[model samples]
Target: MSRENTLLSASNGGPKQSPVRSNSSDGEKSARQRSQTPKVEFETERVELKKSIKFSGALAILLGNLGGASIFIAPTTILSLTGSPGLAVLMWCVGGLVTLSIAVSVCELALLLPRAGGPYIYTLQVFGNIPGFIILWGFVIFIGFPSWALAAYTGALYMLSLVYPDCPPPESAVKLLAAWLLVGLVALNCTYTSYVTKLQGFFTMAKASAMLIIIISALTTVTSDHTQENLKHFMDNSNTDFGRLCLSVFAGYFSYGGWQIITVLMEEVQNPVKDVPRALVSAMLIAIFLFVLTNMAFYMVLTPNEALQSDAIAMTFGRRLHASLPYLLAILVTLCCIGSVNVVVMGQPRILYAAACLGHMPRLFAMLHYKFLTPWPATFTMFLGALYMLLSGTVALLINYISLYVCIMLLVLLLALLHLRYSHPDREQPFKVPIPVLIVQVILTFALISVSVYEKPHELGFCLLILASAIPVYIVFIYWSNKPRAFVHLVDSFTDFIRKLFLLELPTTYINNHR
Candidate 1:
């Protein structure tokens, strides 16, 4: 068997679903039905994706989340949060370590499952469909789309900042333009999904390289002129408590959120069980180092006050250094941003495809372009969703609601890990989350609580409310479509209670090696 087929056979828990013919009474899924989602009958060509590409270490971490905006803005904001160059880098180091803990946890779950939909797939198989669906849609519309919009908007504004640093533009127009750009991004996603990894690789390399240059330049040229000598004295729980700072860093951290978008397409990855961890860890390290180094560089060049007030922090350094460099940095930043945008454009549609495969959505989404071997319809739909978000003006507040979904997905993934630990004890998976891993998960959960507890109350409330809204959507669209009132009628609402309480586990199949 070919490697691709072997990977598919192993990755897919069962045979692909196909349209059933009434005459053929064979007890099996049909190939035709398995080929496409039943909902949309758009023409598709199956094109196989390349799986040989490999990314190592921090690049993998960077691959998951670091996008256009982080390089442009995160360093300055982090520094401003500290109000001191020395302390800002320190916080980045600390935050990177903390974020890695979560990455490690995600890696643990991802390797074991090695499927698409990342946290959503893990959760659905473990907890059940309800929780999984919530996380899945939460990511699809809320977290994933909004983040892309925010990134795109940030990229555009960053681009604008290059030409007109003095223009005090209102936030409203920025969002509408972002929304239009989101439509463009969605259209870009219609191109192809498989090749996007390479694009991201290039983006990752370019962004890191340019930032590194800036860092080196800053370090070489930085004198005590800009460094606040007594700024460290003010680093305390005064401006915002330690807890709030940590949680709000979620805003900062969102910049690095897309690295795992790769895992959402685990089925397409070559040797995912092995590669995924390597990618996650490597990406995290690179992002961590770059984040720390970049912050230090920014401090060397711009004071915390300067960094915070200016959106074009990198550009600030470039403008002071040379005439062409700011635009040059913007060029690289735009490419990096575009690359990240392409990466998301590649990822979310597959999650939608996964949902379709699970029968939670129309099956046409599962269809692959015969020519491209990619899920075109699913990809396009996600592109549209992202466009809508881009059109929305609440980029800053909007993304947090998205993060809440991302967090919920993480929560569900933990439950998935908990479930798989028991349900398929002897599965052929090579990786396992050890007992100590669980201990770390508990600690991470506590940390999330600490962050969420003392974090901005208003943002927290909004996220919760949005999450709550998914319950009805799930019932109306997914549940009603699958089986209306099936749960409530079956067990006098006990079934409903179990589903809500335990989450509905809807694995791809119970069969083994059936693909």
Candidate 2:
């Protein structure tokens, strides 16, 4: 096919080909047509995602993911690693600013290609099949959903804390709760996009309120308490170890990680050109303010050793302020984790759907529900992946693996941004980031990955092993055209069954004018 025709096919839905008719008797033809009627009906029905998300919804999606349990939990890790209250807070500010730069640069790409897949789509368009497939496989399949699994697990643990206040919850109970949360949220997402979007706004507000409560509580105790002593010598006993500092900064970076997901839902936003940039910048600023103040509150309310020793930093901070406050904070933190899972289920499937539409993944993933116009198949795919990770009991290792994997993904994406700029200078880009900002982002990413490896060299091997696993899957399922007939037919039958079961149909792709 010509480039124009290929683009046309994708925009229409998928690759379009002429149907072949056989020279069979009328009775035989009728029998075959009757047997294939459902498949024909499934292919004929098409739809698009509703453009219902405005600035508030867009900000909610970004904040919902950005202000996850990480903020409440990671401060202790950052403080412990840096061993200095001031240095730890500085790391948070630095991570926020660096991440802001990356977000704006991604805004440029989002504007250039206003699509659903975000980086996956950009990498596919800028690079080629193998690179794109690697991103979809390694990032979404390996890193994305597994991170959600970790969130669900954390949420479950916090939730169970309310029930078992004196001790911990059973491992089996935590797993069961996490699984139920995943199942319930996926159902919500598959039912209505607006339902999940509205939930994001509500949960984000709850998270912000929890932080504000902590900040205000700290301020009220200022005159009576000696918490200020912790920050008196801000840089005292600061760790100078390069590896540990890198780990600390990366922890801070993880708290600011979810802003990039905003670009993935450009197609669903009401006004992508204006609202996307507005929401991205505004959400980052708000998140940074909340995180910095909340950390200051932690150090102000509790001693450094107290803050470092506590397993749940926010819960401990609440308990120090009031006997009953820890219970309230636990509920809020659990909601934050649930909100993270909500946004993950909301956005990540779109990446899979986009890849499937491009023939990089199974076509079933490209299908949308007839009634809801949502990507049920892809969402279910994420649920299954997360379920596997949850049951395997390797979530902690996956979390570590994901941190490194995310840095590598971001570095490659930044390089892809540079490649697009010089290689396609003539292409229209409305929101251009400064050259220095891009340089800083690249340098910071490289430093993090390098130091992380220096600290734990074996992690690099595990990360590589996970990433390299994608290559063989791609070569077998996607790269090779001559798949076995029976195997292909079995896959097709399975896909057809899923489509019928969920009442799913292909969705039309929106190709922006610039691309």
**CA lDDT of every candidate:** 0.61, 0.81
Error of 1 at 180 (Å): 7.0
Where in model 2 is the C-alpha error above 4 Å?
Answer: 1-46, 510-515
TM-score of 1: 0.76
> How many steric overlaps does candidate 1 have?
42
| Tens digits of lDDT, candidate 1, 161-240 | 55665674566666665656666656555555444555566766767777777887776664554444433433433344
What lDDT would candidate 1 get against the real structure?
Answer: 0.61
Candidate 1 segments exceeding 4 Å error: 1-53, 56-64, 80-83, 161-189, 227-245, 248-252, 422-428, 481-515
- Clash number by candidate, in order: 42, 0
